[model samples]
Target: MKTIIGNDGARPVNSTKILSPVPPASTLTIDHVSIKIVCQYGKLQMAKISRSSDTAHVTYLTPEGLKEARAELEFLKNEKRAQVADRIQKARELGDVTENAEYDAALDEQTLIENRIIYLEDVLRSAKVISHPSGSDFVVIGSTVKVEMDGEVDEFTIVGKMEANPGKKRISNESPVGQALLGAKFGDVVEVSTPIVRYKVKVLQIK
Candidate 1:
């Protein structure tokens, strides 16, 4: 058994299993601690934590994001589950499942659906809805920011990892640029570091 402590030193979390192996004395940030109930075992289990990034332990979502997640979960549990079950039933009626390709595929699809459902459930359970930043003093999650890099100005909305879509100009708060922009105020230049390149972006505006 290993005990996980919060970053704030609030309390110790006891876990019977360590999802991602780390040194016994390794310190984890608050973003790495995840507590979720396992439907299979009917017990709470600490989820795997990645060494590089936050892995959905404390999912941050905007109100719209939360609603979207809920709608998807409902569809998966209700419509998608029933559709897969029907496919399985039809496939089972065809012949022996041991050699039936349709049956095998249906079963595989069912497993994927179940896995997605579990993930969504865990995310929703641990979700923390982020509101629009109350002030423009500093960049925070849910803040729309305008920045200048390489003498070119660009705008981005800081969102959770789940809602991140670079093509859509929505960036994840955990992303290199996003992380660098966080806590930066207008007129502040912040350096974004990545393995490939490092550049500085000046915060021109925050909304």
Candidate 2:
């Protein structure tokens, strides 16, 4: 909304759209400047975060998990997309789109497919293929931990949220139990607290 004047005392036509005054493109470095296109949503152009972000926001995945995510994304794009498009075309032949139930359902399915494709793309982009590391000193993202609670021994792999399936002996690193177990070693007693219940777990093993 403000005018950006260059050294020549005239607004640079190409950069006038910039909301804030930026020096000439030659003066701005990759680290100093974040180019944003003036679009519908103002998407960042070629944005790159630090490595810490890559690790912190990273989705830890086994080789198998990574393969599955890619497969699902490809299937949705290559197979489901065409199917939805075909359905929509046929539904459009039925009548007006506003009153057509088949058209609406097909459109909904297309939206879901597209959304899932986007999700999978993000996931794969940020994915870190981590095999379960071998360590007995402390628990980490790829560690399988065994804990004793109330005379019962439960073993579960501590994994990122994307690959967690508690019923299959896999738990999310964000979970209370998983968070508490991280960096805990054998014979260390850790307390796990939830809104509904509180309990303690003694570390039995880590692998």
Candidate 3:
């Protein structure tokens, strides 16, 4: 198997120098990666990348994404509220609230529902939505790359966390294949290693 050495930008760069694969095998280090969230049209998107800092950055959704999140949260909250109200009314008709099993159960349900609503709201507030950059060239997001390996051809799209799925070959930018192909040009050879197998991949097309 062939090994592709990483370049650290010095002239005739240290070809002999190799970085020991970190344990836990993260595909890419999100050093100084910035995250943002936004919503557009009706779809929500999340974006992330390694920035020029010592930490990782990630971004997600647009205004549209936030709207969708809010809608779902509202639905859940309202449904729970109605259920609790009905339970309380029924318990009141049974006479004593202090001894009513239905009243206690209804209160417990309300408490759980409220907790879930708060949890969802917190997650939405912290989510970073990806904003599609105009003229985003070089496989930033939503770009499909076609590759060839040992005469076998395959295609993959590098996408956000929500869209990443291996079953459809829609890989995350943080995956082995995706990381190996980032910034690569057509006809260039790349090496990718996973727990099961290693790949000698060639770029046939980038779109």
Best by TM-score: 1
Q: Estimate each model's TM-score.
A: 0.72, 0.71, 0.45
TM value for model 2: 0.71
Which lDDT tens digits does candidate 3 get at residues 1-207?
335545854344343343343332223434444333322222122222223333344534445556766787888877857877788788879986545677667666665666566545554655676554444335555567788988999998776554577898777777888788777776888999898999799987777
**lDDT (tens digit, per residue) of candidate 1 on 1-207:** 455667876554546333444333333356554332222222222233322233536889999999999999999999999999999899989985545788767766876777678778777887999999866699999999999999999999999999999999999999999999999998999999999999999999999
RMSD, every candidate, angstroms: 15.1, 11.2, 22.8
Which candidate ranks first by lDDT, i.e. highest? 1
- Distance from true location, Cα of 185 in model 3, Å: 2.1
Clashing pairs in 1: none
lDDT-better candidate, 1 vs 2: 1
Error of 1 at 130 (Å): 1.0
Each candidate's lDDT (Cα)?
A: 0.79, 0.75, 0.62
Give the CA lDDT, 0 to 100, for residue 149 in model 3: 88
TM-score of model 3 (CA atoms): 0.45
Name model 2 segments beyond 4 Å from true: 1-56
Weakest ten-residue segment in model 3 by summed lDDT: 38-47
From the highest TM-score down, the ranking of the candidates is 1, 2, 3
Ordered by lDDT, highest first, the candidates read 1, 2, 3
